[model samples]
Target: MKFTTVFVALVSAVPAVFGLTINTPANVVECQPILFSWSGGQSPYYLTLVPGGQSMASPIKSFPTQTGTSYTWNVDLQANTIFNIALKDSTGSTAYSDIVTIMSGSDTSCP
Candidate 1:
């Protein structure tokens, strides 16, 4: 009985144990389009972008959708800057992606 209970508990906790995982590049050029993807989480996710290395309280982007796992973000910010992505489910549970480095633009400087 003890073994069975333990096994069941672990099985039930799988989802919470293996929360969300975001997949994206560590470095990307500025003013380019990139796709951010995630797995192991629920649907109707919210994507928020926060500038890296800053103590900003608000996110740069608060895009919410229930369409797909990948989100296309246009990196039109500044070069050499870092950005972090946060994906949240309907329950307010969130998963964060690794910080990404933005390279210089191939054209004019970012506005």
Candidate 2:
């Protein structure tokens, strides 16, 4: 019983694993100032817009490096488009958010 107690205590001491995270939904409005947020990984991260079915070598757009966790980004792309945010940290760690589709006007659904 003593051996079992020691094993349990050791396992609980492990730190929680938190990978790079971005909080944007799968769909957003076009031509609006959207709030973007992320966590984990190092600072001075860069962002790129990877269009759906396109190679990562050619991003549609690229943003400046960001050090803060959250920021407001203006979306000027066309509606009914698909894309993803490729986030790369200063240490070369990279992460990609789930695929996102753009919507126009007050309508937020895809057909």
TM-scores of all candidate predictions against the true structure: 0.78, 0.73
**Worst lDDT 10-window in candidate 1:** 52-61
Q: Which residue segments of model 2 deviate by more than 4 Å?
A: 1-18, 53-55, 106-111
Clashing pairs in 2: none
- Put down candidate 2 lDDT per residue, 42-106, tens digits, no spaces: 89988887887553657887888899987677777778778887888887777777778887866
Best by TM-score: 1
Tell me the number of clashing residue pairs for each predicted model. Answer: 0, 0
Query: Which consecutive 10 residues in model 2 have the weakest lDDT in total?
Result: 13-22
Q: List the residue pairs that clash in candidate 1.
A: none
lDDT of 1 at 38: 86
Instruction: Report the C-alpha lDDT of model 1 over 11-93, residue by residue, as the tens digit.
Output: 99998777887786655778777788887677888888877744244787677585578887777777877778877887767
